[model samples]
Target chain A: MIMTTTAQATKTAPTTTPARSIARLLLHGGTVFALLALIVFFFAMRPDVFLTFVNVKNILFQVSILAIIAGAQTVVMVVGDFDLSVGATSSLAGAVAASLMLTGVPIAIAITVALGVGLLVGLVNGILIAVVNLSAFVATLATMTSVVGLAYLVTAGTTLFDLPDGFNNLGQGRLLNIPLPVYFAIVISFILWGALRFTTIGRRWHAIGGNVEVSRLSGVNVRRARLLAFTIAGLVSAIGGILLAARLGSASAVQGGDNMMFSVAAVFLGMTVIKSGASNLGGTMIGVAIIGVMSNGLNILGVNAYVQQVVTGLIIIAAVTLSSLKTRQR
Target chain B: MRIKFKIAALAAATALSLSGCAASASSSDNGKPLKVIAFTSGNQTPVGAWWVKAVTSKAKDLGWDLTMIQGDFDFQKMNPAVESAIGRGADVILDGYTDIASIGSIVSAAKDANIPIFAMDSSTKETDGFAVNITTNQQQIADATVGALAKTLGDLKGKTVMVIGHDPHPGIRMRADLAKKALIAAGATIAGDDIQKVKSPASGRTEALALVADYLSAHPNGLDGVWVGWDDAALGASKALSEAHSNAKVTGVDATSEAIAQIKAGGNFLATIEQPWPKILDKLVQNVSAYQKDRTLPKTKFEADDTTLVDSSNAANITPSDKLG
Candidate 1:
């Protein structure tokens, strides 16, 4: 009787153990699992189209600009600060660049000036938040409002189009049948990931975000780190805005304004997947991928755009809740 | 001393009588210029900005005392500004490119002040407050766009078309609905079985591009055409078709320069409707001038003008709507 009972217990333990481990993994990496499940579900539902090469490329191309903007937001989030002005910064840069080109400014010069505008905005934000000790939220909000006004002023409340071909190619041009923006997104992501993972400044940023007081006492130069984070965010956001203008072959005051909310949401969604429950570049990319996939899938399925939004909001909530529960378990 | 006081009273009465006569004359049209308050909630938009410039120029030509109030799509700012301008006194209030529904407070204030509001592109239907509102015919615009799609596709029957629109815009929403019904009536199937609504006008192009690209990815050759409510989104749809090497035709309203150029290039962009904004504005200005000459309002409370469809044949001749002075 003892031998028979032991045999049954051993059999039950093997099956239960694997199931428990799988559940734990899914709980910890909720965003990643959710993304995988979404992809699989879409593919299963539309086997011929959802997983096709062109469709995959389409998804990547559509998300390229978003990936860059979300990455910019992630940089700020890493330092425990987020900028609400990234969208406005992008729009202002694009408008400035486009208007300059219209006035016979060389494309190179216009693009450089645009990057400068972005850097300047970032520096101003850093000064106000880091140097003046103002709240990042309030300071960035002020900058966002000012930048939107500037965008309108630069464009004179008109859409600027018919850009030079060379400049348009930055957005619409393709390399080996892949959109240039896709390559830009990938390179930017890698560079950002490297900066966060390998560089000494990256470690300092992590420390500062982990514990501001401790990092300050340890001579980590918290102010400079935080300032740099904001500046980088501004610069990256500008790149995104410029690309968006290129893609459309036009620049308008409101063109890049919608990225702010989406980028913040992507960063928040990304935070749930990491064990530290902190924002990371990889997790942000996954978050962006998830959003891009959901949009593409729903569009392919002919779902109402409004309903897609509701579904996305629900997924975010679910992912965060699952992550929170896992944290409680730990 | 009594005689001097009697003389002073006689002089005062005479002066008072003459002043009253002058007041009566001024009130009865003694060539006083109209005090005009031109308000627009959409002054940040391209067409809105053009309206501001055009109205200002018109007011100057008519020698009207014009105060331009740009709302920048903010009712909170615009309502109070219009109310203040009303309080300060205006002969007539001119509203441009702002939905009448959004300015209920300003309308109430105008009503209280007994000032009739002349509006341009403010509403599709006649509201009580507006003396007259002139806007483009949305149903006509839809018919033209959908007709272009049908013509390009060779036949509407058994064809698949996507109707893209931003629902927040009343004109766009109405036109999109009309276009969808027209497409179905013509025996074409609506892609996604509904109008694919763009969430925001600011991001309409990007969203439209994604919407088309995604749909094309699944049914690469399934789509015959795309009907967009505005030119910006049409441009996006055109780009998607271009990238995919698809022969699907695209049509849009708002004869923006880019849309005209696309039509001229004979690409995926097949046609666009020019709303004749300048012509509409001129008519409104004329009506206002008639009112200034004699206290009069338009006989019709709501008027919708027909738009010109700019396809390949007439694309070159039509001055792009964006370039209007």
Candidate 2:
């Protein structure tokens, strides 16, 4: 119903000049162009460190976890829900996986159980929101608190660093000069992009988010849809947590606590880039790269770490403002 | 129900009277009541666990009445923690956090209340720490490490070095500052413009890894040595140097097991100045006890923890920690 109104509004809207359309396109692709400029500038300044294959690999390796979390966040945001508990969910999963590994659980079984924890948390989040009718924010927040507590409980309030070498290899191993995590991130994003583009469940989420009452009246199975969306978010958060623990060769109660900010920031930034003014897997990945480059590049340039933070905050504000430019007209 | 209620009231009254006697006894006689507000909660279990264990055992050893408050690493939580400690009628307070600037009003308020505050790991103020200030002589550690780096290169006359540290507290900044002075005194050039400060211990490793890589990129083979204030920063710098295959030597403080193991394995990490943190806590407890008996603060405001320089030669005999000790 909301899509129909949007279609009508666009049809009735004033026509734009070819020049104006091209200008809009250029403005929309600013992030892509800005990334290129940053690369060229850094390369000119430091060829050996900035331009090397190893550094490129390092950037990919560092940002790989954030990129995966961002993809998970995009789906939930598209459905007009927030999973604030994802960071804690990741920590809980990591704690469970690492602890299990130490207790002589096979790596394969331990990882599967770790993923199961995420799915289970997602089920709880889904039930609390879709069936029990709690606001997404309040529900996920409750889970986040409890899950963080569970993380500490599982590890007995200490960091677990005594992981088997095989698990460490998962975090550090590279295939064909690329880190294993980078592959996981790329594969997850592509799979999500396909689902969002080609599936009915994915497309209907826009309708549900736009007008939930109308979608329910139109037989949209609103509860089931929301439940599935949350489940997917939880599953993906598990993947991110497991990989992060694997990469660091350590898991602590605080492992995934700060990732919510990164994931949320990346999704919001992606909205401005996609020109759709909504979350998309492709756009989220691009946003992740922009953030990754900014962090890696600023560090490479010998900028004070605090100054890097200021620049990042300004960039986030600019992104939100850019996305709002045309929306203000509506 | 009425009989049970009467019994409960009588029990609470008796308990209150006994508690009153206990509080007055501790206050009037020996200074046995010490309330400790730790920066990290015991639940954090990794970063601030040792401090908790040392202080707890020391409180018992000194026969002090201990009331512990966990700060949970939050600044806002501290004001209440302080107020509660004051409310508990503690004779004195032991603190592990160092954000004196932000927590100044609260600390000053405690001073106004006549409850003296003793700080741990915070810089020594000659008159500030009511009992005695126990702090690590960070400059000496920094200088010692820098001297090691210079010795490794045979001479520091024309070499270049970088000092990497986190500036969450004054001690870390002091260490980095002293390292720079020593490097310059040895006729070495300071790499880049100034010391690279990490934001905190939480992300210290990642930040160090990236910043060191950046520094290495800018200077290439120009850097001769690197000095880090803490083990995490040292680990990060060591990784950057080793991965880059640079010839620069790395030195750091805190003989974290990983750092010792790395040094023993002949990795890029050269040497670390070890300050056994428990020793400082032990001394702080003793000084505070003596102040109660004599009614006088120490003549010297500060007591320093002894430091050991750990390298491949001595790493075999030292214990290593996976996390920063």
Model 2 agreement with the true structure over B1-325: per-residue lDDT tens digits: 9999999999999898677645643562643354443333322544466666667776677666677666656658766776766655656667663545556655775665566666666553444634456777776787679879877999999988888877766677778888888888888888766888787665576567677776665556767888888876787788778767897888878776667767877868899977766666667666666656554556676566667889888888775432433
What TM value does model 2 have?
0.85
* Residue range A206-275, candidate 2, lDDT tens digits: 7787678998999899999999988998999999999988876777777756678778888877777665
In model 2, pairs of residues that clash are B257-B320, B257-B321
Residue lDDT tens for model 1, B26-119? 4427667778899998888778889999999998998888999999888999899999998877778999989888999999988866678999
- CA displacement after TM-score superposition, residue A153 of candidate 2 (Å): 4.4
lDDT of 1 at B285: 86
Fraction of native contacts (fnat) of each candidate: 0.88, 0.38
Off by over 4 Å in 1: A1-24, A322-330, B1-31
Q: What Cα-based lDDT does every candidate model obtain?
A: 0.89, 0.76
